[model samples]
Target chain A: MKHIKTLNTRSLQESMKKGGCGECQTSCQ
Target chain B: MVHQYRNNGYNIVLDVDSGSVHVVDDLVYDVIAFLKDDLSKADDAVTARFAGRYSPEEVSEALEEIRALEKNHQLFSRDIYRDAVLDFRNHPTVVKALCLHVAHDCNLACRYCFAQEGEYHGVRALMSYETGKAALDYLVSHSGNRRNLEVDFFGGEPLMNFEVVRKLTAYGRELEKMHDKHFRFTLTTNGVLLDENIMDFCNREMDNVVLSLDGRKEIHDKMRPSRNGKGSYDLIVPKFQKFAKQRKELGKQYYVRGTFTHYNLDFARDVLHFADLGFDQISIEPVVAPADAPYAIRPEDLGTIKEQYDLLAQEMIRREKEGRGFTFFHFMIDLTGGPCVYKRLSGCGSGTEYLAVTPWGDLYPCHQFVGNEEFLLGNVTEGVKRSDLVSIFKSCNVYARKECRDCFARYYCSGGCAANSWNFHQRIDSVYEIGCELERKRVESALMIKAALAD
Candidate 1:
């Protein structure tokens, strides 16, 4: 069960690396 | 003028007009029949010619080509076929096993029972010992060389007629020896009549025993009181606890099932009471009332029952996370993704893959329709052939029903149970009753919620 925490962390890191955190400024005036 | 082309062999009616071809009725059955025939022929050819000539890769490629053909044929309706294939591949046996009502007769009479209604008035009779033996023989012979066999003993109360159960258990052991097969047994009982002798036999022979307990003393007493109007709950509940303890000491697997009717919908809190009694698994089932039973809840009240059941499910899920074993049969759709395949689909080789024999040596589609004349497939004595059983299975296809062809859940739930459909609609293809929708929705919602919570 504790390994699930590591898997989640790895998923989050992969998501961050892939720019899935939505960093594009679409509302720039 | 429109040109209509009907494939009689496939039972598919194709209407081609204006250089466009449109598939009617989803053509599920036609495609299934085609694929089954193609696969069978390919298998036969491979077995005959390539006995030792073809390499493993060649055989795999040949099988893959057949599968691809099935896919191409179902290209227009790919999703349906894909889902069906996934279901089939994941669970080879659409129904893992069956629980049969070998004997309907019971020793004690509970007030809130459905078996006592109408035709069942005479139905509380025992299954002949001959029927029991024939059923075992039918199971062993027809299982298609599948090594493992599973059977569950069910009844108005199974142990009341202990002689038959004991004989069947012993007979099963002998059958296992003769066939060199593994057999597993499970029994569900009311627990009032379960004694030392029964427990000893079960502990040795049976794999698991499920005792029905309905919450605390008062609710159980009021709901399932003995025929004499005495509070049978107090006596039965303690006995259940004692049985669980003895099972633990003797290293036997046992669980308790709590049935919730309209009256005991709020007994979720009392679930822990059974847990405290050292019971491992608690299966909560909603009481099923016969169509004309006086105690039956109205259809409208099913919504309330669902709400109550949802709350219980959440609590049970929490308990499960904490390492306490629990299961609610009502929440089985949640436990197993999608509804029960049997409930969703109408026929899956009923008499072909599974079968039941009545007390008089009459064979039927499963135990539920044993005594009913309509469901009788054939007799064991008169040389029941596989072809006859296949025809019986084919007749249960709900696609023939016009209403079922257009149902929203048609692809998944094939017009509810075959016997129920025939009994109610007088046709297997009619749209299922509202109760079927309500139950499926309830379990589906529960499953969705449970998945979301897990995420």
Candidate 2:
């Protein structure tokens, strides 16, 4: 619900800059 | 029971009752067509059995079976999809070269160096010998015999810690011997400490060397002076000339990079000074403001940099056409022509195909965040497996960031550097900071103008 709520008002651009729901933060290397 | 019928090109009927639903859509028509088309009698019987019966429970069971079949189909189809995508990937491998910061400590302290953070001098935390070995090992092991390997050595001043560089170079040579792989090596330096030994090393082993020269004597000296408050240009120019002479004699490639801060923006005449230095390849980079730095660009100053860039690009193009070549350190043309891949704007390759190891044996997404604790991927002591790295890569899709999806320059910029994106905007796929955006726009516009003029 919180993520959905955030998605509702936040521009897709803003959400993307947040690195896509914290997915980019994970250490892949 | 209620019967609902829907048709597009074919007719289908759904009948719902107390515990069963029937779908009798096109069964008779299908049987008639099959029979008319000379279908085998056995096949016709099979079709006819299902044709008249469309009970909800029966249909539900059939649908469940179909769903299970579809799942299996998809599981197998992924291989086919990957194969199709592989064709695109195979056309030309994206150049994902890195200028590894084999050494971080610099000989001189520039006033505007980003590595300086309130007593947290980043230069001192140089990559150790062990760290360099680990990084090289990682690169050699994971590269999977990738045909083209271009490596650049970066630093506060890479020469400040030349011993580690020597070790890495030796390791690289050993790896090459084992794998029979060839690599290109280049060094970017401030040029103050370059001497015969360095020149000899570069001539024999390296492909290209780039020197950081801000511009004319006054500007260069003012911006990049010695820590003892003395001008560096005068001290370094003679050494640069010697290096140039050696490069000419040795037939080695060399480039000069000029970084422009706000202080130098007002002066365009200083650019011509680089031309006088007998250096042909000149690169101009705008002063990049850190995450905490103020975000304001003077319109006039930006215009000045643009004007100089246009003039330089035009001159370089003209000279190149005349068979008298001059190099400008802009990668847009190389990127567009598919000769080089810029990691920053190209895509998120770090932690996916590329990874950086810190001096302390900690893995990172890339070298840009070498000392930053937040960026630590894993420790060497833990001995992370290859499969673990692969899963980590799959999970972190920087391109999926909503901001990146929506940005107009997403294709070109690739959400800028992922590390910068995470640190500054707190998102990996976010648009670059305002200053970066402006600088990129200026460079992009200049490149477009150059391309058009050449055309």
Best by DockQ: 2
Q: What are the per-residue Cα lDDT tens digits for candidate 2 across B312-345? A: 6555556667776555545343322221112222
Chain A TM-score of candidate 2 vs. true chain A: 0.30
Instruction: Show model 1 residue runs off by greater than 4 Å.
Output: A1-29, B1-78, B82-102, B111-114, B117-131, B245-255, B267-273, B276-278, B290-292, B321-325, B333-352, B383-415, B428-434, B445-449, B452-455
Q: Write the per-residue lDDT of candidate 1 for residues B139-219, one digit (tens) a residue.
A: 677555566676677777777678988988899899999987667787878877888898888889888888877777776
Task: List runs of model 2 lying over 4 Å from the truth.
Answer: A1-29, B1-100, B117-128, B248-251, B267-270, B291-301, B317-325, B331-336, B339-348, B379-412, B433-455
Backbone Cα, N, C clashes tallied per candidate: 1, 14
Candidate 1 clashing pairs, residues 3+ apart or interchain: B344-B413
User: Which candidate ranks first by lDDT, i.e. highest?
Assistant: 1
Worst 10 residues of 1 chain B by lDDT: B13-22
